[model samples]
Target: MKDHHPHKSLDDVHESVPIHGGKSKFKRVISFFGPAYLISVGYMDPGNWATDLAGGSQFGYALLWVLLMSNVMALLLQSLCTRLGIVRGKDLAQCNREIYPKRMNFVLYVLAELAIAACDLAEVLGMAIGLNLLFGIDILWGVLISFADTFLLLYLQRLGMRKLELFIVGLISLIGMCFLAEMFFAQPELEEVVTGFVPSLPNSAALYIAIGIIGATVMPHNLYLHSALVQTRKIDRDEHGIRKALKYNFFDSAIALNIAFFVNAAILILAASVFHKNGMHNVAELQDAYHLLGTTLGTEWAPKLFAIALILAGQSSTITGTLAGQIVMEGYLQLRISPLLRRMLTRLLAIVPAVIVIIVFGDEKVGQMLIFSQVLLSMQLAFAVIPLIHFVSDKEKMGAFVIGAKIKFFSWLIAVVIAFLNFQLVYEEVTDWLSEIDNVGLQACIVAGALGLFVLLIMTIVYPWILKRKPSRSDIHISFDDLEFKQASSFRTILLALDFSKSDEKVISQVLQYNPAISRLILIHIVESASVKYTGGQSDDYETRKDLARVEQYAKFLKEKGYDVLFELGYNNRIKAIRTMCGKYSADLLIVGSHGHNGLKDIVFGETVNKLRHAVKIPVLIAQ
Candidate 1:
């Protein structure tokens, strides 16, 4: 005999009407699936394609195992991210700000942002090069053309996020088909391809390429995007719904990633069989591969297939990269730069160097710049991975869904290895550059400077490990119990902010559940601008009517629960209104929903409820 009362359980409202509606069950599922999968594969951008192709062409399938292993690792990490978002109802960037110290959090945010920007540069360059190959446009003109494509992609987003996702899926499928066609035409020797899966490091360069492959596949921005996108689902916090969401998310990620894996493997295997066998070693571009296709396969079909695939690969990656930039900006900074502005920023950063190179040194120099951007990506991987590993491993924070011992150990090991490899890559590049200096005095000066920097690096790494500080009481702030709300005595009033969203309803219900002693409930809905029209006019008469209707509905709902209910309505800027309402109503406890903000604003401003805490000297209860 289950309880029939609404106050006794949340499951009673689990099947309540959703704000967004559709005609069929299948339509609902389809609607939820698009954002996670299409958006996640954006991590596998044009830079990844370049690295995969370069690895196969140079090392002849020796590095194929890296992609296989990295994808598995990526799956585990992304699952943790999705779980974190579902459990906390907040994105990874916001979670980081909560868990880490302010200075450290800001530093991590900057590094992660830089990595995304670098990856975007690579995607833009790849798209330009692909356009040049397919349409016979000049590389410079192609770069500008790719910039134009950004506006078109953002326009599709205005149709709805789902439409944009569907369009990307179509592009990805087309690219996958092109690769499948090439794989069929090339027909690599099966035995050698099978042996490539055994994982052998032939040389230092092969090891480096393997590192690049892993770095390119498991990107930082995808973690942020996937976690944030999962929240768009209408799923409740019920155990059953959570389990189902996780299961579906896993299926969604696996299918999308497997397609990515096939495309990656086909590119590697095709290059290995076609280019590596011949003594012609220095395959610089996709065009270089096209030239070999005609000569090696004894057919014109191979080159044509390669060119078409390259075009698809480049175009698909570009769209995703831009989307990632948007997510990062929105999630970390709590600022929305329109898509066109974001694209222009990315293009200018990538193209300035590329255009200068083509003008002075030629198009060949731009190819080197593309590889340089990939190397830059490899360097920044650790900044994002370390924070993710630390946060997911915190048992108190993540509860039962925290990362297991085995997963934590393996991920940490990978992070350490990647950090070391990035250091070596930076060291080698610097040393090689220094060695090329013709003047002996200048070369000696450069060597001395490098040695000094290396010593500082050694000190920075060792000092933290050797002189660890004892954990102090000052380090602690609010605990879990502190966040839990308690009812004030019967004489006090409680101010609750409502957005008319389901999330707001949850907050109200939570307040009634925990603290039934309230004398009155003051409901607030801030009107941001005076000129901004509501469903009715902005006149006082219309506003008063709207407020009365909302208050009456809430009063009726509370009366059915057998509680004396009273409501008041106010309008102003959200933060300002919260402060004013708190003082005027003399709120014993401020109850507000956590939504609309992310990252640092979520930490400093404290979302909706958390923000009220700093503004007013009162206990703010954040209802998730």
Candidate 2:
């Protein structure tokens, strides 16, 4: 292992929430409440509403068993996520990066991102439709307006995780309240509602919607998000503490996900009672559902409540999408960017396709688009789910906390079931596409892409179980508290790289004071003048001569102190040049001055000392 701190998951809020395990039992349980509620919002987002509405309207509550089944699966998988985070101290993305090779991690990262984009597309469309239904805004403008939620996310993040959790829970409560009123107005038949949970598919179309409901309910991104979110609560690492956390997190997931299950069931029931009863079996479009709810239920508030709930669901889910995007990008790629940029990039990916669909196909197509996005999530589900199961079941990594035989069996069962449904859906859809396309080249291309993805999916399913080894524990020992001091070793030959600035005086002063036994000084400067950069030492321009004079002068000043000094001048990339000169002189240490610049300055004007340290093999000392 490398000698560096492991990157934290959801680093802004890692261990930010206090567990308060020493407090009253009720108080201790309350600390575990927020993460699951944040997670549950994803389960009941606009994606769920879209799937539920489509499933109920088309199949008339026949697919409600799918929702129930999906919620149960979500509970199990989310508990596994909690187990992974608490026991391993890493999120799912981080675990994948550590276990899988880089190229493989990249593929998983892309799939994770595609899942987020698909999830966000549902939110974008849901938000836009809510605005359009309530305020009569154009769909394109509403989607364009959805871009502003990036700022909302930024503001909420600044307020902290506890507050963000509060906001999400409030929105979820609002959605719950809205649905309760809808269920009352719709008055779904009790016997038929009971019958919906008997686990039967009415037709092939119902099977597709059933899969969408499963996709929306057991979302892939939530798996990654929950693991990282659970880490926000500060807890003891002892056995009793871990056991306590697992129990409370389980309760948290159950309570929150049950609420989500109710919300989904309510959407399906409302659509089934009002639309199916009225012989309006094709009420899959959200706009159609909104307009029909008022007249069909004979109440004006029905549509109003529906739109309000849709807006809340879309807004709340958008926040989690931002966090998941941050997790996968940072975890899989070890890349971090400003939250603002990340949010914009994610929303933009969803927005462009949404706006294009609305403009080309119009608002009538938005509902299908939403359903398609959920199905896309289903297709990507196996990639995340398989690796998560593999991780939790690994005894070497998880130790005593490894999931037992039952959980191991059921988790893999869930993965297989999801893969089976996705494969069936692909088979049907591909067959339809192939038959419709008359061009041989297009058909060949489609077949090739399908085969390639199938191969990748198979690789993802088997790689962790068969080939991966648990990463070796770090060998380097570190003592944080036990302190020891010894006489400082001095550098025998020091290389000082400088710019023609007054900071050079401070740099030389620091070197002389820090390393008194320095026997030789190699003063070097890299002239970056336009004329000499590409030409290197071959260009003898006036700017190069001026840099030469500055270097010689510095050498002369150092020599006066009775030290042997040699000056070298080079051009082009300063980092490479300094590295070459360091090796050329056999210097033990390289000293460079800080520009006191960071952030945008480092981006625009490169930070030489930072780059030079990594480019060279010797010790680098930065002078303040």
Candidate 3:
């Protein structure tokens, strides 16, 4: 009963392959090696390349210590993450829903997905840039081309977990080999390379790059990934077996992360040797780095190798990013979506802005975006880190494996330091921009950025403390259908809202099916006003005529069907309009066409049905 809520992690694969080996410590350790390797790929993703390139090109390996230090922190945090999974058979997402109230868990999930999205943008940009280097394709088209990998990811997963791991390891090897070959040819200064491992900040310029490196290296989603991945081996739950698995898992995480450090370090060292040493200090962009590698090293293969490594980095990271999205959605929100759909959803989120940026602005901003994306990842670290520390530190949750005083102190210290560094990065990045943007057309950007960061800082502090009370078992409901059916007959006055989607016609038809004897329907549509007044000065002819005609069709249909219909329209804040209409009409029930968003999006954005349920006191019905 100690593991009362012991969920079957990766329920599909766990039953397919159970571990049986009891002897040979070496062989036992190797089986636990795959998850950390997967997690380590995130450490060397395209986001890291952006930061490492900037650091090495500008400062010539002065900030390598930051990479080393960040990896150390990652080791500690990842170890704690796996302990949660191994001890409780629960990943970080599961632990979160179990620990926090429903409201707070949803918030945490949003922040986690936001962090994933930020990383995805970096991946998309890097892939586009890599394509530009390899084939001279435009970045916009390159971004669109990256979408084709969605099919590749779906196909790979169907082949099973072992094949996927082999595929990733092969890609990781390709990246390492390409970089290893480049680093050898570039021949970085041995003395400077050794000294780079020493901790030093050089100047404020170096600090910015150093902070970027730290942010890039320690990803929030990797924490979630590590916890879930470790459970794939299906280790024995007995005391001796648990202890053995923990020991080997630690070894796996350490070795894999150290190799990740090598990949990150090699990228920096290659940049420092080939670009910075040759007076090309501004090789910050992926395109610039690719071209300069050939120019500086006098080898045609250099640029191609750089581009290949980048493509591998972006592709590998995107695949893992999709996996992380699944773990997060399933673990936090209990929504089991197909990996393909989730991948497409996340890819689209990353791609839409990327496509827009390439179109409106030039593709050069991809480099800037890559750096900024890592900063956003830094901002979200506290949300994942604090919770992992809290849950692992809790004696009740972790039992015999709960963090000790020394571990807890250091873990909290890491969390506080990361959060503080993120705040500083934002402050400096924004204020530095604000100082440069004293002009007319962009003053608003600086002001908005400053305000945004201020709010972010406050959220960083207050977010963890929310939902402090225990989750109430009584709050659980088996089916929304049951609750809605229990009170179906009580409806007398119904408020129905429509957005004029294809679903709206069906919504109207369905409500007419309800066919109440004495009940009335208040049919409403909101034009969603932007400013204080309508754009046409409230006396427009053609546009308002079209809107009126649209509403009349619904009203005429309802009236002809022998039911009373009251038509109304409002502007802005749809939630407030709906609530006001409900109260003013004394409506017993409110019905709206659900756009049917049921994944991370529905949870994050508080979809129409959900927000309505929370906003109004009346029973809300989602029309089929």
**lDDT agreement with native, every candidate:** 0.66, 0.85, 0.80
Model 2 lowest lDDT segment of ten: 472-481
Predicted candidate 3 versus true structure: per-residue lDDT over 302-402, tens digit per residue: 89999999999899888888888888888887777777789899999899988888788887687778877887787778778888887787776567888
Sorted on TM-score, best first, the list reads 2, 3, 1
TM-score of candidate 1 relative to the true fold: 0.66
Sort order, lDDT high to low: 2, 3, 1
The residue-by-residue lDDT of candidate 1 on 421-499, one tens digit each, is: 7656666766776777788888788678656545543432343336543231111234455597779445456777777
Per-candidate TM-score against the hidden true structure: 0.66, 0.80, 0.73
- List runs of model 3 lying over 4 Å from the truth: 1-9, 14-17, 20-22, 432-469, 472-624
Question: What is the C-alpha RMSD, rounded to one decimal, of candidate 3?
Answer: 10.2
Clash pairs, model 1 backbone: none
Q: Candidate 2: misplaced stretches above 4 Å?
A: 1-8, 94-106, 151-155, 184-192, 297-301, 329-344, 355-365, 395-399, 456-505, 514-593, 596-620
TM-score winner, 1 or 2: 2
Which candidate number has the best lDDT?
A: 2
Clashes of 1: 0
